[model samples]
Target: MKSAPRSAVLHRMVMPGHTCPYGLKARHLLRSRGYEVEDHHLATREETDRFKAEHGVATTPQTFIDGVRIGGYDDLRRFFGLRVADPSATTYRPVIALFAMTALMAMAAGYAADGTVLSIRAGEWFVAFSMCALALLKLQNVEKFATMFLNYDLLAARWVPYARIYPFAEGLAGVLMVAGALHWVSVPVALFIGTIGAASVFKAVYLDRRELKCACVGGDSNVPLGFVSLTENLMMIAMAIWMLLAYGM
Candidate 1:
């Protein structure tokens, strides 16, 4: 004889204009775990509020198993002995992904253009691609990036607008380098920012021994201020010097 299937009750908000993502996740989790979910939809704001009040809970997507409250999505994960993510934890995922993607892109570009991925041009593309990608991340929210950058950047501390201009300059330099055009413009821009950035990062993370979030990927990133950030700045500096020497600019 087979055992009876486990059952769960899920109360989630499914308004006309919006649906709660956590609620969807909860339902999926329950179903995936062999629980038959009696899904209830709170279709309006008033209905959702009333449900929360009646249950004495602050949030929706509440789950119940065997007549016991399982709370929200994170709570449900806890019930199943799953690891919950801590929002405050420092992570290197963003930087890792950014570097991995840019590296792949560089190889692809090299293979397509020069018929080889192990050439000097490929290495140049890697650095240029990384610069553009990092600049793009910073450009997403300049105000936020500037705020984070001011915490450690010497130039930004002195001149507020430098923070805002940094991303654009980096991007322009990267684009020019990739095109192999306007070495006069790209070399100087990359060298100037790279020098300042490396000095600032070294001072903050090495000399001061401060544990802070890096603004390399973006203002919202949780990547620690350390070797990866230093490497990024150093790569730009090296690329700028190489361009200057190679083109005699």
Candidate 2:
């Protein structure tokens, strides 16, 4: 039997600025292959650039299987083909997007009044602020969001990362929403916001058996199987089905 080749991943671990999105996803992809992975986060732009120049890595998380560069996360995904997208293995980008969108939008609307799109409240700000967070999660792992309450977390503790970062970002969006910063057509804005969140949640869960994890209260979420959580995601799923049906129609 031919032995499996050893592999490693190197990611520049920095917060609030770096493109760790694709990098982390790549690492997760490699992890699924049972390879020896090593991640190195570039702390400074100079370091990252130097590493990039040194290794000819235009981006990260760059993959090295026995000292060979294989590009970033999407490349690795293609390398692993559809296998890494499986929850039973590694990589869950779709699921995370779905739940994250719904949760962030709901929290954003929480600080607004009926018919008043923008107000001097926290909820409004959170609505806008969630965009960046949403982008990051999708950039990392959408599959996890799709199958949060499934077999993936059974072997990993990051079913919920310790980073209570989402809640804080939501707070920022809520502040903006309430401050009436986004008062330019709030209803449609809210709906649009909700739609993105819904789509993210729907995609994530659908790819992972329609099972879901309740993304409430940020990282410390513990609201039980409440009606809102169930409906928010289900509505997203329904919307997705509608889109699919419309397209197929």
Candidate 3:
């Protein structure tokens, strides 16, 4: 003897201009869980509103199992023992991903140029690539980045325009470093910004004991302003010194 398959009823939005994503997800979930779904599409705004008002629910994609309401998509997920995301949780995933990607790029570049993945040049490339990537993120919205940067950067606080200019300087230095050219220009640029950045991060995070978001990844980023930020600046400073010693006469 075998038990019959579970059955579910789903009411979801399917408007002309906008189909509800949660509704689609709910339908998919029901099918995947071996439920025979009787899906009802509220195809118009009026119909959707009527459905909501009648059901006394504020949101759509409502589900029913065994003649009992199972609520919306999130509710359905909970019923299935799925993990729901916490919107306010802090994470270091962005910086971790950035560093990982840059390391891989550095290794690839090393292999392409010198026929080996591990070398002094690979280390240099890693720093240079990271600088370029960070600069790109900041450059996406310079004004936003400048606002966030002014919070901790001593130089930016004193000279407001430096906040805007910082990304370009970092990017130019990085490009030059990667090319192994124009050491005269790149070395000074990297040293100046890196020194100021390290000092600012140390003062804000260590000395002043303030917890804040990092502008290193960009203004909107949730990445914490602390060790990772300091490391970025230190790497830049070290790279500048290394390039100067290796190329400067």
lDDT by residue for model 1 over 1-249, one digit each (tens)? 999999999999999999999999999999999999999999999999999999999998999999999899999999999999988899988888888998899999999998887789989999999999999999999999989999999999999999999999999999988898898899989999999999999999999999988999888988899898899899999999998788777
Q: lDDT of each structure?
A: 0.93, 0.48, 0.94
Best by lDDT: 3
Candidate 3 runs further than 4 Å off: none
Candidate 3 local lDDT, residue 98: 96
Cα lDDT tens digits for candidate 3, 15-79: 88989999999999999999999999999999999999999999999999999999999999999
Which is superior by TM-score, 1 or 3?
Answer: 1
RMSD of each candidate?
Answer: 1.4, 17.7, 2.2
* lDDT tens readout by residue for model 2, 1-249: 988767675665565565576766667667778776787777787877888899876765677666766676766777766534333432234345645664555555653344443443333233344443443443354444334433222212343441233333333433444454443333333344345444444455555454444553222223332343435434433433433354352
Could you tell me the TM-score of candidate 3? 0.88
Best by TM-score: 1
TM-score of 2: 0.32
Sort every candidate by lDDT, greatest first: 3, 1, 2
lDDT of 2 at 54: 93
Clash totals, every prediction = 0, 44, 0
